[model samples]
Target: MDNIDKMVGIRIKTRRKELNLTQKDVYAATGISNGNLSEIERGNVLPSSKALVSLSKLLQTSIDWILTGEASIIDNNSPEISNIEYGLKLNESEELIIFMLRSLPLEEQLDVKNYLRAKVAKYEKSELSSTSNHGKNVMDGNSEIA
Candidate 1:
């Protein structure tokens, strides 16, 4: 199975067990067929974004959490959706954050995340006037740090 499939399956299993839910219960709430969900939970299939959203809500989680086993965490596949079982769109900043995250080692990812959080907090709190500058410094045609 593909890595994305594994991710999906792992997330599904994690959530299902966390809530003491059965595959049938998920089917009842998410409208995903039992066979499909079973395959997905076994890493035999990848779920679409719609399916991911359904599972997320049923599991009381976010799409990112369902897809990558991490909530509010960025990774290489965050923007791709190449193996997502559903179709959905990500905002530009979200996309950029994911892309940027891809360049860091897994161990360093949390550090980068902390930096990003600090940046946002600094700007939001007006603790750093420079943080209010335009995105020209960090934005490219496709990726912007703003």
Candidate 2:
């Protein structure tokens, strides 16, 4: 494979690992065989357009990004999010969430966003406290041992 093909393959492999997906999972989702995926990851062969499209959809990325390492800009005025039913294959629950979010009023959607933000803040605060406490305990334990 050439440099561009190797770069694309690296992007594919990196994105797959980021999603914590195995080759088997990718194969099941994209109908691409495990051997093919392995070869693609190793930069031995370029993937077809169909496979690239399937991977971009499954990985929630753009084909341009996968192929050229350039991030595609999403137009705010465009109905890009709503047009997800085109080639993207989302699970039922994911589809339902998008539907429900789209169905909500602007105010309700803002409220949902605020609620999620607050929940994330609380979780992060708790995690930080736990980590600090663990560090303190380790320090104290070392002092006692010494």
Candidate 3:
């Protein structure tokens, strides 16, 4: 692959990680295949302009940043260009978690996965209970819809 292609791939991979997204997530949102996304991220294939546009929107960055690693001169003073730097940075906690997970043994990884799934289920159940109570309250005129 060309050097420019590698740079673009790095940008894509970096933004995807910063957003805590998997290739599957990016594929689902952008209609890019997971295999293609992997290839693009590895710099084994150059991304199409359309793929770059979709990725730019979904990853909340600019095509300019993805390709050239800078805001175009014309957009330097724009408020909208200010957040692009953040897109290249993964959260420290997220980076730690990924590092830890990768270091775990396979069985321990499965244990961690199970623990996270249970926690997520608990959170979802609580959210559903709260939503149901809120709906009931509104229907009974005991609470105003806000």
Candidate 4:
């Protein structure tokens, strides 16, 4: 494989692993077979335009990034976290939250941040409580699966 192909394959592989998705998961989502995906990741064969598009959407990146490793900038302050490329990786709800946050005044941003922190704390507490109860239930022979 040539240098560009290898680089593209490496990017694909890296993004896939970052998302904690397997080749089989990608295949199921993109309709690209596992063997073909493996070959693409290995840079043994060039992906077709259709495959590239599908992979880009499934992997939440752009074709340009996949091909040339150049991601379009949306925010200059934080290239990795606040760029259009990073936004593309977020779901619709997350993107909307980011957009709304960006629209708010500087002082309001802190309020929103605090609110989000509180929500996160509440969610973590609930999760911990549920987990502890589940463990107790399992130990007490009251778990459904047991």
Candidate 3: tens digits of C-alpha lDDT, residues 1-146: 88988888998898788767788778766789999998899888988989987888667667888888895322322333334545555566666675676566434656797899999999999999999999999889898756
Question: 1-146, model 2: which lDDT tens digit per residue?
Answer: 69987988899999888767789878766889999999998888989999988888666678889888898633322344545547566667766776676466444655786888999999999999977877898988843332
lDDT of each: 0.71, 0.77, 0.76, 0.77
Candidate 1 lDDT, 1-146, residue by residue in tens: 89888888987888688667777777766689889988998998888879986776567567787776668422335565522534667778877776777565433655786788999997777744555444444464444544
Least accurate 10 contiguous residues by lDDT in model 1: 74-83
Give the TM-score (vs. native) of candidate 3.
0.49
Q: Which stretches of candidate 4 lie over 4 Å from their true place?
A: 72-146
lDDT of 4 by residue, 1-146 (tens): 79888888899999889767788778766779989988889988878999998887666677888999897512422334544545546666766787787566434656787889999999999999999999999999898764
Say which prediction, candidate 1 or candidate 3, comes out ahead on TM-score.
3
> Residue 142 lDDT in model 1?
45
Best by TM-score: 2
Candidate 1 colliding pairs? 47-85, 48-85, 48-86, 49-85, 49-86
Worst 10 residues of 3 by lDDT: 73-82
TM-score, structure 1 vs. true? 0.47
**Clashing pairs in model 2, backbone N/Cα/C closer than 3 A:** none
Please report how far candidate 2 places residue 96 from its true position, in Å.
Answer: 3.5
Given candidate 3, what's the lDDT at residue 117?
A: 95
Ranking by TM-score: 2, 4, 3, 1
